[model samples]
Target: MGQVDPHRPPWVFDCKLTARTTPNPEKFDEALRQHVGRPGHWIDLEVRGDCSDAELELIRRLAQEADTRPVVVRHVAKLISAGQEEAGHDEPS
Candidate 1:
């Protein structure tokens, strides 16, 4: 995990969205390519925070008529410690 800087604002997903509509009808797919993978043909589009006006407009349009398709959200993977590893203890039988 990355350390947080006190001066900068914490990462926020205020604009996070899950839309089921495809993006084939949009004209500005290139602008959101980095933010929305496969924007032109994606079945699901997840929008994070901090998007430009143009990008936001496209996202807003997508959200208006989202379909009933299932939404897919990817989560960050994390490693967990059970304390034994840190305390130099092995698994007990």
Candidate 2:
């Protein structure tokens, strides 16, 4: 883990990956209601640091199971950095 800058806010990213498989009837079904046809599992992935290509490739392979859906990427902004003024100004708009 990187050192946490007390003055700067953190960045967060959320990703969801899904895979289809034979749903466990015992796990999916309740005694009151029977789950007949649910056949997939939705996996929730959260990244606090940077997500590299290799890490993404592994997620892609796991999500590419039969009857699976594409991976969904979501950007969640926490707060703007308060101390990195010089770095922010160097970037072109």
Candidate 3:
């Protein structure tokens, strides 16, 4: 959590790291698609801080135009807070 920066979107708290991988544009999209399709439940794609303009655009597409394969999605950005960050937890600056 941004204990030092209050203006940070509350959406920051609700994020869950569903995957980690090398920087490959195709794989980023592919992995997110697969993850949201997992059989356990419906997953809303929540996005926060982006490292680049490309990434911002990518998230925009996913949260807007991403209806490719295995799922039909017309996403709406609904912010849900997971409250505060736990001890020893940190988000990249």
Candidate 4:
């Protein structure tokens, strides 16, 4: 896990990512609930391996509705791989 800079504000929003094959509307609502009055809160997606297009769309919508900045979906894959490497997993050639 990456260390948080103490100088930065603590995160306020946390949303677990839905499976690529399944999307839970209830979860979306729950995540949005955290957005109330916390526009500066960082939304963290708990992706299980990979995130689906639908999941990304839902996150984008939520971000827009919550008046938060949109995140770049492209970096998710790289970040995941980096995390795996940090955990001592060897990448296949």
Candidate 4: which stretches are off by over 4 Å? 1-48, 68-71, 78-93
TM-score of each: 0.21, 0.26, 0.29, 0.31
What TM-score does prediction 2 earn? 0.26
lDDT of 2 at 89: 46
* Residues 1-93 of candidate 4: C-alpha lDDT, one tens digit per residue: 678866553553324433343235466545455533345445544333346788777666765665555433331432332123233357689
Evaluate candidate 3 by giving its C-alpha RMSD to the native, one decimal. 11.8
Off by over 4 Å in 3: 1-28, 38-43, 48-57, 68-93
Which ranges of candidate 2 are over 4 A from the true structure?
1-48, 72-93
Q: What lDDT does the true structure give each of the candidates?
A: 0.43, 0.39, 0.48, 0.48
Give the Cα error of residue 36 in candidate 2, in Å: 19
Per-residue lDDT of 54 in model 4: 89
Backbone clashes for every candidate come to 0, 0, 0, 0
Rank by TM-score (best first): 4, 3, 2, 1
For model 1, where is the 10-residue window of minimal lDDT? Answer: 75-84
Worst 10 residues of 2 by lDDT: 28-37
What lDDT score is found at residue 44 in candidate 2?
Answer: 36
Error (Å) of candidate 2 at residue 11 is 17
For candidate 2, list the clashing residue pairs, or say none: none
Cα lDDT tens digits, model 1, 1-93, are: 688865553653234335444456454444434445533433454444345667655555654335333334322222223211222345679
- What TM-score does structure 1 among the candidates reach? 0.21
